[model samples]
Target: MLLARIIKSIVIIIFSCILLKIIQYLLKKLFEFTKFDTRYEKTLCSVLSSISYYIIFVVSLILILREFNIVDVTTFGTLVTGASIVGLIAGVASQSILKDIFNGFFILFEKQIQVGDFIVINEEFRGSVEEIGIRSTSLRDWDLKRITISNGNITSIRNFSKNKMRVVSHVRVSYEEDPMKVIESLEEVCSIMNDKFDEYLLKNSEGKSISEFKVYGVTDIEKNPVGAQYTITGVVESYRYFSASKEVKLQILIVFKKNDIKIAYPTHINVLHYDNDYKNEL
Candidate 1:
């Protein structure tokens, strides 16, 4: 009888594994059938897949226990009572953890943020989303530091990965340089960039990347002691923001040099004075 029971438990475990595979397959089909936008769809699929797998595993564990004759009415009742008492103690001791879990579900279902998104939390920490868990969210910053914050503490979110990001380039030139000439040279540079890195420039309504360049001429003119600063702003898809910024700056440097535009640098003037009285004293 013991050998027969052991064989039954093994079969139960095998069946549970097969059921889990079926669940995964169905979930994949469901996600594909109800396709949303790219980023949202990916995030939704990830969270739901994880949650489903966890549920199936828990249910399977109970079935396997039953197959081993380990679960009975008396035992289950005692376990439930013990769990209830423990839960009550835990609830009172860690109210904030419960709040974190609640808020975490809200964040996931409402699609507030997603994995791989570049975000600023409370305008304090800027990082890319690594994982969103029931209790906390993990972020990986540019410096590669992993920051974990409880979901309940997240008051504000600035999601940069959702829409097009503005690329602001500030080019400084000597006050002696003609502002018009500088602006004109920048326009030419933009023209060249539109052709050079066309694929990374912009996206049309159909989500196809296209060449689009805009020169917001001289957004700022700061009269520093050294020189004046000119700010140029343009928009590009968020995915390409970093690469596009670097390319734009390189093009700006090359264009400035080609146009003989003088980039701002500190200059010191030394003066020598000669006087008859000073000569006599010497």
Candidate 2:
């Protein structure tokens, strides 16, 4: 009888393995070849497979007990009671962990954000979505900073790369330059960029620019200075930044350089400081 039960358990285990393999094959054929939009797909599949696998093992346990003629109610009651106590303790102690796990399930279902998405949350951090787990989502910022945010803390989300991103850069120039002239110079720069990117920068495609990215003249800046020496103080806000490549920044740099305008740098100038101080002291 023991040998017969062993054979039965082995056969059940083999059948369960075959069933799981079939399910896996069907799921693969169902979803198209899309890269890991979510880590939970095959991972969840494996979790399910493990659960099913355990069910088979449990059946084997019952069969083996019956074969040994020791399938008694008292033994079953002892096992169930111990399992219940352990489960109760785990449920109480792991509420937060369970919450994260449930939230992670919703995240996967709703597709809040996926890997390789650019998102900003709470002004605390912004970067590419590296990994989204049940507990936390990992991000790698532009500066190569890795941050993990819990699913609970992620209330507000700003996904910039969902469709297209507007790369905005602001340029502040002296109020002396004509707003029209600056715009015109920028338009010329835009013209050049349009031609250079015609092959790659795509929008309407009829010799048109990639996208209508242009310079909006001076916004606002405080005229007041340290000692009121600098008269023309203002800021220009430029919008429509859509270059996936790093060429946009370079183009802006060249635009400023060609226009004889330079990015601001911090410097302190003292006029005859030593002589004046010495003379005053004397």
Candidate 3:
């Protein structure tokens, strides 16, 4: 009988694992069919997956215990009482874990952050959120390193994906160049960028897709390079900021080359002095 019970326990464990996979697959398909927003879908999937896993684990544990003749209908009430007492003790002992779980719920309900968001947690850990679990959140940094932080510890989060991002490019040109001419060239570059990257640029209040890019004029004058720094600013979708910034810089370079505008670079002067007294002594 003991051997038979042990075999059944092992079978139950394997079946539970298979059931979990099937549930997860079904959930993914359901979300895909519903056509929910990407962020909402990801967040719901993660939370629901966690809930399903816990439910399966608890049910499986109970079944395994029953198979061992440790728990049955007759002793179930007693088991519940014992579990309650143990739970109280564990809750007090593991307050941090409880805090994490509660904080996780708040995070989900409050919509402070969601999966796939680029965020800085506690103003320290900056990365893309990979998962928001019941007790912890995982982030994948630029280097692809996964960082798991407890929910309770996340004091602050700066979500860069929440709104349009400003793409600012600063171009330094030789002071000899005309400021107005430089501004005109930058404005031309802006117009070209607007035409080419309309989809990436943010829309205006009139529901029209406009680049809203302009030259900020000479922002600073650098003495070392003897150049005037011009600022170009535009708004683009957060996800497209990096690409938009790169394109703007490239376009600036191309336009400057075509216009024969000289980019500023440091020039070093060397002075050589001949010491007549030292030469005579030698």
Q: Which residue segments of model 2 deviate by more than 4 Å?
A: 1-76, 140-147, 198-211, 223-245, 264-267, 271-282
Separate clash counts for every candidate: 0, 0, 0
Clashing pairs in 3: none
lDDT by residue for model 3 (1-282), tens: 999999999999999999999999998899998877898899898888888888898788778877876555468785785567557767786789788889999999899888899999999999999988898999999999999999989888888887688888998889899888889899999998888878778887886765577887788885446688999999888888878899999999999899989888878899978799988987
Give candidate 2's error at residue 224 in angstroms: 7.9
Residue 88, candidate 2: Cα error in Å is 2.6
* C-alpha lDDT score of every prediction, in listed order: 0.77, 0.58, 0.86
Return the TM-score for each candidate structure. 0.68, 0.58, 0.79
Please provide, for model 1 over 1-282, each residue's C-alpha lDDT reduced to its tens digit, 9 standing for 90 to 100.
788878877887788778777876786687787757756665665666656666776666556556655444358785575556557767785789778878889988788898889999989988998777777888999999999998899999998886688778887788789988998988887887677777666678896655466577654455566677776666788888888889889999999999999998888899999999999999
List the candidate 1 regions with Cα displacement exceeding 4 Å: 1-38, 49-84, 143-145, 206-211, 266-282
Which residue pairs in model 1 clash with each other? Answer: none
| Model 1 / residue 34 / CA error / Å | 7.6
Top TM-score model: 3
lDDT order, best first, reads 3, 1, 2
lDDT of 2 by residue, 1-282 (tens): 667877876776687678768776765565446565444354444335445555665565555554555453357775575556547766895777677667766866776776666788777789877766667778899999899887766777786655444444455555555556566666665565555644434344364433544554454456423111111111111112234334555666687678875444445887764667788889
Candidate 2: give the clashing pairs: none
